[model samples]
Target: MSAIEVLAPGLLTTVQDLGREGFGPMGVSPSGAADPLALRMGNRLVGNAEGAATLEMTLLGGTFLFREGGIGALTGSDFGANLDGTAVPRWASFEVKPGQTLRLGPTRSGARCYLCVQGGIAVKSFLGSASTHLLSGLGGHEGRALRKGDVLKIGDAREAKEKGTDHNASSTEGAHKSNRLRSVAAKALELLAPRKVLRVTPGPQSDWFPKAAQRIFYSSTYRVSEEANRMGLRLAGPAIREGAHGEMISEGVSLGAIQVAAGGLPILLFVEQQTTGGYAKMANVISADFSSLGQLRPRDEIRFELVNFESARKLFIEQEKLLAAKDLIV
Candidate 1:
């Protein structure tokens, strides 16, 4: 069977899919790709299901040798990727031959990158997902980041071909050089800017903070703290004080929930966040821009902008349309 032999395991490289859903009730966090959009896009480019398991690389990417010829794609961040020492393009698919080594350098822009192979990575699934939940060590390849000498099996490429979704059938290298491809690539690259303004809506515990704290949160610029991880993003900025009620009963927390700790610092919850949090949340990032959080690096500046539910819903629909566009991949 076709497989990828890991020559070097990059910093925190793990297998992830759409995530483990319907298990939050069991106290399981919905661990998945930090940037689901990028995973989906890379899978689409390789003609695999949108949620196919992918190798999510954080900060730095490593080297791998393909044991069989196949098609692969990299998306999300530009990690100075090269195939057999020849530089390759991000957000595009390319052919990989057996014995060819793929290498990825330190990140140039974004914090995370997704590598997708045709037919996806064949790994044992837990709770119906191939995602790696590090905290619980529940899924993915032994439920942890990859290590050197690990051999990852590849799914049946012929299945994708029979389904008429083989990316090799249409040359991605040639088509990806077009103007339309350039536009999409530009948009993807824009998501990795040093400073970002994210849209948010009031959280369930928004009232716990005074109006002044809310104002400060919206107006002040916060820097992504080095303590940030897949579980939460710790922001260092203006202290947001609580009102009459300082503490609250622990309740369920959702992705993007901005919870304020005892020291008045806000922590933005992410994919691996706990199911419930005791701190009060002032706001929650809208679904439309949640994926952008995956690209934020340490010391990156962030500002919050309030948006209504309707506007947030519209933006999400627009993003969905963009992801559904087949021509965008080429």
Candidate 2:
């Protein structure tokens, strides 16, 4: 199949897949979609599987000329994309004709956006995944961002159903449970704004802090600080102190591990987080609410809530069920 020719690469675009798994124990970071939800939903809109390699565009997207006929989807940020000078709707799959010129501008809403083609973007694999480890320079366009004049191959074209015409059908959630959406099923097709409410589970080191510290974490409002990125997000808010607590050896770190630094500042870890950290972790923003977290830009206001592991699991299940039901109609 012909590939998409990069004419004018955007600010920060890279080819990514579902992300490398089972390599965390080896000190290799699980570098995947900073926003897995957008990756999955965008791929679903097209005909690609959840783990397929796609393009991750930062705030500003770029231009590309389709050399082969295919279909694609754009999700997450609204960068005001267009095809051959005609506007293309966000969160929907559209036909990409050969020789067509597609253009994307700087982000207007969310910080990142994903572009999923019918045939996934084919990139070199590292550690068994196509995701790019920016820090270590693994599986991407030579472990770097996409460049102008790059010719990335697209998977061979296969006929897919009329692009999500079916409704009410359930979908698989994170390789585990199946969920069904009950409410707002009617608005599945209607273009709307992002509905974001992030829920979180307690961290492994929650007990390290006192009761008052925990209360402040949940009570004080926070915003995404300017010093945030794929590795971690440094939050700006009340200096949440861990009263009468001392430091310990660094333990396992995950995508949403909330760590309080020496200055009493809080930060949220992301995909490129270190294998271990020594900071005091208070809680973890659960997987279900991670999409919203990924959307946050510098100074974006947000709130936090505490939850148990079981409750967090249940929330994740519920979200997956909702997405499944939307699959039926949208």
Candidate 3:
């Protein structure tokens, strides 16, 4: 099988699938797509499974050379995508021929870009997934970012056909680099707009915070610090005042758990967060918008809206059904 050739490696591009399942008990984070919806949609565009192994490109993804003909769909962050020197429409299905080079330069909108090819990337897994958990050093191409000269064997190129409509694959403005994903309406909007609000529900330890902290939590706009990454997002804002029990015995912390440290700063846990955390959890981001939380940039402002668990679950299921697994591209 002819694999993708890493000609100019992006800042940090790695092979990731849906993520590792059933391993959180052992403290393995499901380190897969930063924007899972985009990943899954892209996979569907290429007639791949929802959790097929794809490339997770960072803020500035590098270039690659596809040696054979296949359907390639790019989602998540639009890092100035170009399908062989011409502008590649995003949010819509596009095709790449063998020997063509796909370029993803710096991003103009979100933080990560997910590239899904036909079929899926053929990489061995450590724990039933192709996602790479860098902290635990599991999955992906040796659990690290891709470098020049690395070759990734892909699944059958011919069978990797796109499954959806490419409705939003047209060009948009301010696309020096863009992340124009296919909206429900199939519009190609630029991703450089204002950072979006991230809704959340009060945490298991939300009561640990004082009244002052709770009030500030919902009202104030918090900025994501540069210290943020796949594991957690460190925010800069008014320190979240906590109760006397600064640190509790470690307990399971689900994805999107927001823990406030001793100094009062809040951190939103992501796919790579530890199974257990001692810091007081100020809030829990709903799974529905977990991918949006992963897209925050440095200095991006995000406000939280409180929702009940039942409401959150409903929103999650509704969102899941919004886009079907079939014919994701136009």
Candidate 4:
């Protein structure tokens, strides 16, 4: 079996996939890739299954040494990646040689980056998922961020060769063929700007807040607080006016739930959010823009735009089509 030796663990590198589903009832958050779309795309570029485990790097990237030759690709944020001192392109697959070192520096644009190997990371699964849920210390490499001297087992790259074409060919050859399509897809990912306008719909407890609170939520620009994390994004903006009956029974919370805490500030629940929350939810982010939220950094400004359920569904469909298009892959 092949392995990757960690020379330096980035800010918050972890092994993740599509996330653990059907375990929320057990109080296990669907801890997975903050940017699922990027993780899937990276896996696709390397000819791996969409749900294959990949390394999720936070703002800063780490260095690693491949003990065996294999194929790998980087997606999401461009973190000035270089393989053996040679600058490599993002959103494209490249080959790695035995004993070669791959290094990634600080991020230039986005908040997170996904590094996918040809055969995915081979980690023990919990709750049928290999994702690392930090809060609960469940799944993935002992459920913690990778540390120095950690050795991660990787699947056999030859297994991918049996699937027709060699997706892990040299970068020059692969780049020449799919440069244009990759460029288009890469551009779409880059459109997630520092200041973004996210689409949202009324939450289950939308009526719990006063009308003034709703107006402020939709109209005000909120800054992503420095305290934000994978579990939720804390926003700093105008205080929302809660109704006299502010207290409510704890209820189930879903991804993208905009829960208003006691301080009147809103916190957007994310992949690692608790199964249930006591805060009153005023709105929910549309599924189509979850990727946008994933790329947000602390202090980034954001505004919410209201949309109907039907429109949200249509947008989600369009997003799926864009990611699943055959032309996007080589």
Candidate 5:
């Protein structure tokens, strides 16, 4: 069987998919790709399902040896990758021959990068997902970050190739597919352009914060603290002075829920965030900005923009429509 042999596991490389949903009631948060859009695009580029498992490299990237050859693609932040000493472009598909080494370095654009293969990574599923839940250590390859010398099995892509979905079918066909994919990728990039300001809507506990605190949250610039991770990001900015409402009961929290604890600093929940939180959530990031949250790096400066539910819904619909386009890939 075809497989990937890790030569050097980069910082926090892991197998991840779209994540396990509907398990929040069982204390499991949807631990999936940080940049879900990138993962989906990368998978589509390689003729795999959008939720196919792929390697997620954080900050730094890894080196791997492909056995029996394969097709792959890189997405998200550019990590300066090279295959057998030849530089490879991001957001496009490439072929790897037997014994070829693919190496990647530190990120050049954002916090994370994804390496998606045509067949996807073959890992045991937990709760119907191959995503690695870092905090809980339950899914993926042994449920943790990859290590050097680990061998990752690649799934079968014959079905896709037989159906003429593989873009690298022939030299002539490949050139045409490449041009088409480049155009689509360019559009996707524009749609996911980096933004320092994240849009959000009021949370259930938005009233807990006074108008002044709400104003501060909306206007002030906050830096992502060093304490940021998949679980959440702690912001270092002006302390939000919330109205004194006695400690309330803990409730369920969702991705991008900004919780303000005793110190008044906001903790922006992420993919691996807890199922529930007790701190008062002053705001909730709109769904359209979820991919923006994934690209954030330590000490990165960010701001918040307030929008109504209707506006947020519209933004989400527009993004989904673009992602769901039939011409997203060749």
Candidate 6:
């Protein structure tokens, strides 16, 4: 079996997939790739399933030694990666010969980067997922961030290939596959670009705030604070006045819920957020803008645009249509 040995683990590197769903009722949050779009694109580029487990690196990147030659792709933010001293481009596929070392530096564009290989990371799954739930420490490789000297098993490349096409496919089919890969890579570069304005819809408790507070929430600019993490992001901005409505029982909170704390600061719930909270939610980020959350870095400036629930649904549908289009990859 082929494997990759970690030489220098970055700030926080973990093995993650799309994450475990339908388990929130059991006190488990979906702790998958922070940037799901990037992971999907990287996996597609390497001819693996979109949800295949891959290495997720935050802020700083690390060095690794590949024990066997294989195909790989670096997606998400630009991390200034290099293979054997040669610069490797992001959002494209490349090959790593046996014994070659790939090194990556601090992120340049976003908060995280993903390294997807021909075969996804092979780790025992928990609750039907290979995602690392940092808070509970119950999934992924040993249920925690990776460290130096850790060796990760690579799934069988033949299986990944079978998931796409037969190894003995006709030359025409092979050519088509090659063209589709390039086209998808080109489209990913455009679709995944970061933006400063996040689209959101009124939260369940939107009516609790006064009209004046509502106006301030949409008009003001917020900066990602140092307290940001996968579980949530504490924004530093003009304090939003506390809602007049009295405290209520704790309820289920969805990802991207903008909850206002007593200090007037808003906390944006993320992929690994707690299932239930009592904070008054001012708004919920639309699904289309979830990827944007992954790109936000500490101290980064951001604003919000209010949209209706219907519009949010339309936006999500459109994005899914574009991503699933056969022409993009065929």
Give the winner by lDDT. Answer: 5
**Per-model tally of clashing residue pairs:** 0, 9, 11, 0, 0, 0
CA-lDDT, candidates in order: 0.81, 0.74, 0.74, 0.80, 0.84, 0.83
lDDT by residue for model 1 over 1-330, one digit each (tens)?
A: 789999999998999888877787899998888888787777767766677788999999989999886788898889999999899887777888889999998999879999898878989888888899988887999988999999999987545323322112333323342112222355544543323899998888888778898888999999999988889999999888654244788899999999888888889999999999888888999887877899898899999999988998998887766665545553
- Which residue runs does candidate 6 get wrong by more than 4 Å? 161-188, 244-246
Candidate 2 lDDT, tens digit per residue, 192-293? 234344567888778887888878878888888888777888988888776424466878888888888877778899887888888878888887777777
TM of each candidate vs. truth? 0.90, 0.87, 0.88, 0.90, 0.92, 0.92
Quick one: best TM-score, which candidate?
A: 6
Which 10 consecutive positions of candidate 4 have the poorest summed lDDT?
163-172
- Give the alpha carbon lDDT tens digit for every residue of 5-60 in model 5: 99999998999888888987789998899988888778777766677789999999
176-285 per-residue lDDT for model 4 (tens digits): 43222233254555443222799999988888877887888889999999877889999999988664245679889889999887778888999999899887888999
Give, for candidate 6, the lowest lDDT window spanning 10 residues.
165-174
Task: Quote model 6's TM-score.
Answer: 0.92
lDDT tens digits, residue span 147-227, model 3: 999998887633433311232222221121222233213521222222377778889888877888798888888899998
* Candidate closer to the true structure by lDDT (higher is better), 1 or 6: 6
lDDT by residue for model 6 over 1-330, one digit each (tens)? 889999999999999888888997897888888888788777777777677789999999999999996888898898899999999988778888999999999998899999998778989989888899888888898989999999999998656544422211212222334324332436645875777899999999999899889988999999999988889999999988758243567899999999997788899999899999988899999988898898889999999999999999998888766665555443
**Backbone collision tally, model 4:** 0
Q: Which lDDT value does model 1 have at 288?
A: 75
